[model samples]
Target chain A: MEDLDKELVRRARLGDKDAFAAIYEHNLPRIYRFIYFKTANRATAEEITQEVFLAALRAIPRYHDEGFLVSSWLYEIARNKVIDFYRSKKSDISIDEELEERPELTSTDFVKTMETKIEADKLKNLLKKLPEDYQNIILLRFVEDLSNEEVAHSLGKSLGAVRVLQHRALKALRKLVE
Target chain B: MTKERIHNLFDKAKEIKPSEGFLSRTRARLYEEPLDHPRSQFFFESLHFGATQAGIYATAACAAAFIIYMSSSISVNEKQSVAMKRTEQIEDYKIDVTLKDARYYKEVAPNVFVVVSK
Candidate 1:
């Protein structure tokens, strides 16, 4: 998969519109799904997802391997766009001396995101019964389909720390499930 | 959660497919729009001759502006000093002229033009 992605990336980088179209067709859903998970609003998610691909198109010539996956890079762009959207929304709330910090995704936000995930749908109210950090770990681990290493990398936690968190998260989830 | 339960959810979740025509539309959009070259790369690391030339021009313009600013500052200082010197010379000339007039009057014989108009 990585090889195929790289091939498309190379062609896209070289201005091959057809090859890039194939890549766009292949990855748009996954990308859209990722963005949808983050934003939790269909309209906002769709906008940012399209922006990510457009940004990737513009940045293709300058894209460099920064020890990050192309998808990760795309996600980073989406993340920034999401942040901007939230910021714009916040400004509309009322004028103030300083902009409010992005409302850190509360348990409510998590539930909104996981409302569709497997047993999670039936377990929404139950999931909230778990601790925030545990919920964070479970979401990143399963719904996000991130590897343990990738989770650690994304979270800036050591492998041992992530492992410990995962253990605790699963135990807590089990209690909720029971 | 039981494996059976987990598998049940997974299977059901996976069935909630993404929108149809998404890929086709995206492909058409991708082909419809040509890729753009990022402009910020020139700021970070650009090798284009045009970009390099723009950098060189910017550097040269900044350097030239600095030189002009410094030269103008120096010229202002020099003009101020020159003006001060001229003022002092005028004062000195006035003093000299006073002294010369006194000497010329003193050198005149006391008897000369001695019409005592007491």
Candidate 2:
């Protein structure tokens, strides 16, 4: 998978639209999922996800491989975009408030089945209550199943730090669940 | 909830994804805009390379100028020292000749005085 990503990135760097499309297709679901969990709104998630890809498209020409996965880089961009989204809003609208306001819109096609939608929403709400780093650690480490090294690179933290954070995040999630 | 239960919940959340419509729409929009031109990338790369080359050439030229300036100054100093030494030698030779003439005149004068007296 890394080799494929490297090839696609090389082609994309050379202005290959198809290669970039392949990369976008491969990473879109995870990126969108990450953003969706963060914002808890479908429209915002979709918009931010598109913005992340657009930013990636613009920046790929200057991208040099630094021994990390392309997905890690995309996650970093997605994380920043989410932060920027909140910063731009500058409103006191908490995640709970936003979720309540857009209750009906939270269900994406991926969660169309009633049982899965409820489960996903419950998990997302619990995730939103955690501190930002803990939320990111949990989402990227468990939900996305990224490797520890990948999570560390994506979050700009050390491997040991990621491990410690992961433990703390899980403990906090357990408290929320209880 | 137990750790296992939480893990199970995360596994379910993994199924969450963006809608197909959103994915296709985003893809279409992205591709419609176009990727950066390869020519532009090459141009910028060439510009960077040109800058580096120019810097290297400028440094080499400066070094060459300094070396030439230093070597020429050293040679000029050597030439001046040699000229000064030659002048000193010439002056010493003149002084030696004058002393020898004075000695000869003194000796000849004494001899002439003796003849006159006799």
Candidate 3:
């Protein structure tokens, strides 16, 4: 995967639109899922996800391999875009407002379906309520399925530190889950 | 807590994949718009190689200039020091014999000579 990413990055650096497209296809889902979970809104997630990819595309010509995965660089951009989104909006409550504005509740669904959606919503809210560090650890580790080493690189933490953080994050998440 | 349970909770949590046309929409937006590269990345990409080549040429030229300057200055200094040493030698010279007893007098410099007795 690393070699493949290197190849794609090399091609992209040479102004290969096809290679840039491949990179977009490769990283889109993970970036979108990350933004979705972070913002808890599809529209905002889509917007920021697009912005992140566009940012990556523009930045690709200068991409130098720094002995880490190319995805690490993209993840760094995605994380920053999320941060920037919140900063420019000047309110974290906008996410909750987005949650309230979603049309999921107005659907004419059965009680069981509504209950399941409510449970999912509750889980999302709980996940969001965890401290930012723990939230990022959980999402990157379990949701994104990144390996511990990758998580360490993505989060700029040591491997042992990521392990300890993941352990604590899971414990806290478990308490919230229960 | 069991890793399985944690995994299950993560799996059960809201898995909000982007809408169906999300990738296409993103691709269209990406293709339609001209991407504005960050200033730093732009400067690095556009200028680095050219700048490096220019730097190499500049350094080589400077080194050549320095060598030329040092060699010319050193030659001048060497010529001056040689003339000074010659003058000192002339001043330090002493004759132990008079001109009447001298057998051979060889003129080696203007108005100056070394006498040798046979």
Query: Who wins the lDDT comparison?
Result: 2
Error of 2 at A57 (Å): 0.2
Worst 10 contiguous positions by lDDT, candidate 2 chain A: A93-102
lDDT for each residue of candidate 1 in A1-178, tens digit (9 for 90 to 100): 7777786776667566766667667666656755544443444555677777777787887777655446656655665676687777733222111112223446775454345443433543444577655654565576557677766665556779889998987777665555
- Comparison by DockQ, 1 against 3, better one: 3
Worst 10 residues of 2 chain B by lDDT: B109-118
Query: Candidates 2 and 3: which is better by TM-score?
Result: 2
Alpha-carbon lDDT, every model: 0.58, 0.82, 0.72
C-alpha RMSD of candidate 3: 10.6
Tens-place lDDT digits, model 2, residues A1-178: 8899998997787778899999999999999989888885667788899999999999998887988889999999999999999989844333333343334455563245456657778888898789999999999999999999999999999999999999999999999888
Q: DockQ for all models, in order?
A: 0.09, 0.30, 0.18
Residues A44-162, model 3: lDDT tens digits: 77888999998888888778788777777888898889889988884443433333434354344335444544555655687787887788888888878888888888788899999
Interface RMSD of each: 6.4, 3.0, 4.3
True contacts reproduced, candidate 1 = 0.20
Please provide, for model 3 over B1-118, each residue's C-alpha lDDT reduced to its tens digit, 9 standing for 90 to 100: 4556566556755354554477887888877756554457556765775788899999999999999999999999999898677645654674444665333222333334444433
Write one digit per residue (lDDT tens) for candidate 1, span B34-81: 546344543344346457889899999999999999999999999988
- Say which docking band candidate 3 falls in: incorrect
Cα lDDT over the full model 1: 0.58
